[model samples]
Target: MIEIFTDGASSGNPGPGGYGVILKAGKYYKELAEGFRKTTNNRMELLAVIKGLEALKKPGNEVTIYSDSKYVVDAVEKKWVFGWLNKGFAGKKNSDLWLRFLQVYKLHQVKFVWVKGHAGHPENERCDQLAVKAGQDRQRHQIDTVFEQEANKL
Candidate 1:
């Protein structure tokens, strides 16, 4: 089983946003993060998980994800996402991300565990650092079209 810790940070709502992910399989580990010029916290949060799953090299892998975002954890763990999908995601934000997520989500055996941010968890702490660092490193980071694309629908 692979253990993944994920976090997303935004300097401001609709401001610079980024996600940090740390993956560990045995002694080998990898960290991934990137910043978007403008995005929301929830978007970054969900995106972090999506990107983390996308990074996996194989299907049928058992992966446990640690995340601080209730938006993500509850949607999956509490099964609200299925209900939302049944309703065609009406009145929902980030349907794009959610749809994108489901595509990759189905390929793995995945579970989500909620963790409190700023707590003492090791991988969570590292992900926080990486997220903040990437958010701060937005000098040359490209604008994420998803935010603009979705915002246009409103």
Candidate 2:
């Protein structure tokens, strides 16, 4: 089984956000992180899971994801995303990422485990560090075009 640990951070809500992901299977391990010029903590949180799932090269793998975000864990585990999808994601945030997540998500046998953040869990703490550092690195930050455009429409 593959295990993924993820975390996200933002300097401010909808400001300088980033996500971190750690993927492990047996002895193989990988880390991924990226910063966005502007975004929300929830966006970063969901995106971290998306990124980790997208990293898998093969389909139908047994995967378990560990995240601190109830926003993500509950949505999936409680089957809320399915309801949102059926309703065309109206009045929902992060529909774009949610759609993208569903695409990759269907290819795997996936499960989620909620972990407490900043409680001294090793992998979770590392992910937090990666996310924070990435968010702070202004030079390498990428534009979150969808989020920016949506915000502008408000």
Best-fitting candidate, scored by lDDT: 2
Clash pairs, candidate 1, are none
Candidate 1 at 107: error in angstroms?
0.6
- List, residue by residue over 74-119, the lDDT tens digit for candidate 1: 9999989989999999988888999999999999999999999988
* TM values, all candidates: 0.95, 0.99
The C-alpha RMSD of each candidate to the native structure, in angstroms, is 1.2, 0.5
Off by over 4 Å in 2: none
Can you write out model 2's per-residue Cα lDDT over 94-153, one digit (the tens) per residue?
999999999999999999999999999999999999999999999999999999999999
Number of clashing pairs, model 2? 0
Best model per TM-score: 2
